[model samples]
Target: MDQHIAEAIGRPDLIHLDERLVCLRFETMKVVSALAAVRHLLDTGAVRRGDTLLDSSSGIYAYALALACHRYGMRCHIVGSTTVDRTLRTQLAVLGATLEQMEPCSDLKLDQKRRVERIHEILLHHPEYHWMRQYHDDIHYLGYRTVADRILRAVGTRSLTVVGGVGSGASTGALARHLRTAGPGADDVELVGVQPYGSVTFGAEHVTDPEIIIAGIGSSIPFGNVTHELYDTLHWVSFDAALVGSVDLLRRHAVFAGLSTGAAYLAARHERARSPERTVLFVAADTGHRYADTVHARHEEAADITGLAPQEVSDLSELALPWSRMHWNRAPAPAPAPRA
Candidate 1:
């Protein structure tokens, strides 16, 4: 599976997963990120000799843009949040991309609208910069489609329950479009989207006071990539559940995934319980190493159903498995040593 995915991205180290859902084996984000940027430039006719491109990104997207800028010989300017990883920032700077950090929100809340506004302001200050606004770009979807294609091939079945969280919703929307237009067989696949409980934007009922921990999952406003018409169903997960899912993945599967991936996994399990016969595929967006200080720090907290501050939850060792018993760690014991 990794070999196939590597070939698609033209990088042998482009995939992180092995046959078993354990710790990541490679760094595929770099490949996918670059693919997204390059694909966007190609499809939009935005690429030009010495064209200066600007992007507002946190970390993963910034890495991609840096790679794209280097490959295309375009001057790149990245508007990033103060919370972005230092390693990523250093790498982007080392790649000759200009880095600008936006001040943290006064309310201590990281709002997408505010981030976009800040980036817009930066662009205004530098009129020469051409913003590759991800929210409005159709080509971003093409980059994410590669992931969906890999999922389809991995399962070796056309009928699947595709599940993932929606940050910008480009990936989910692209998967939906691919399934819908591919043919009669495509109809068998269902796309399930997961959103944070507090920031449910797509027909989800619950909405709590906003918090900034879950970085790549929530949005303040509907994006062009999120087409309700394409989604089959949407699931809302609490911060606590998402945290438990993250810890559970680490303890059981050895898959150190981010909170958004955990949220999506929880949603997938919920869907799987309703339809156990279907093959389920979910995206592991990134590793948890990046968020060790935040989500991973308070992972053992009790499952809080009430929409309160996450810190209020008490630490509990045994997590109540809300979904199923199919944990990552419960692999079957090897067959008993063969007798004579």
Candidate 2:
């Protein structure tokens, strides 16, 4: 009954993992945003069907945008990060998307910066290309409204906690915003965002994780769309902790999800333990196939999930270690990092 593949894959499967824990799993989560964003653009005359839509992506958004372009009869051009794995690159190519990938770069911030710079450079040559600013634009939030409605219908907003990685702020931020405005128990929904130690979004850039900075969940630069006030709490999860969570998720619940989902799951479990009265639902943004070699392969190295607990911190200055949790208290965005 779906009009397109994006519509089919964009629809998530809500799995009740436990009595109070739920998993909203998506094959490719950003398809929801890309589809709706493109539709809105077309409807509003912001872009036409044959136009080339461009954006910078680490991985997921490239595929999402490509699929959206394919569905809407548009061209997709992605300024890909160094992290754009071969799997995603091939998928994007097969879907008729042009990928301008960056050279090998170990530094996440530099890689992202280079991609953004390249996007601008391309725009200079091709002014006709419409740049889909996934990190900065609010148009990405419009798609999640339908997702919020589905969640509200399945699980009422009463004593609910929405947990997910704080990517571009479009996912968790939009979900919490739409759910809060839905009805009577609107205020009951709490948003708990998961972040990486290197992400500057919540002032975590000061702390560096020895392991890989889980891409997609965190950003080294400031994200314009991230409304810091939407989050009630924040969890900074390291790659090692998330590895355990991802392995445990597949081992226990059989949900094969990406690294970010693992991080969100780790935080969601903590929230559920702290508030048994509240139902915790975490977003599993994508499948585990992409992470099979990177994360899931080293299952032996993963610490026991049962023994892992985040160090609670009252302030960002107190943040430390493999895991840390802080009550953001709907605070304003932190000051942006000084550019070199």
**In candidate 1, what are the lDDT values of residues 119-152, reduced to their tens digit?**
7787778776778777666666766555556555
| Tens digits of per-residue lDDT for model 2, 1-340 | 9988889999999999999999999999999999999999999999998999999999889999999999999999999988888888889889999999999999999999998889899999999999999999999999999999999999989999999999999999999999999998798899999999989999988888998899998898889999999999999999899999999999999999999999999999999999989999999999999899989999888888999999999988888879999999899998765555
Top candidate on TM-score is: 2
lDDT of each: 0.59, 0.94
In candidate 1, which residue pairs clash?
A: 252-328, 252-329
Tell me the deviation in Å of residue 201 in model 2: 0.3
> What's the TM for model 2?
0.98
TM-score of each: 0.75, 0.98
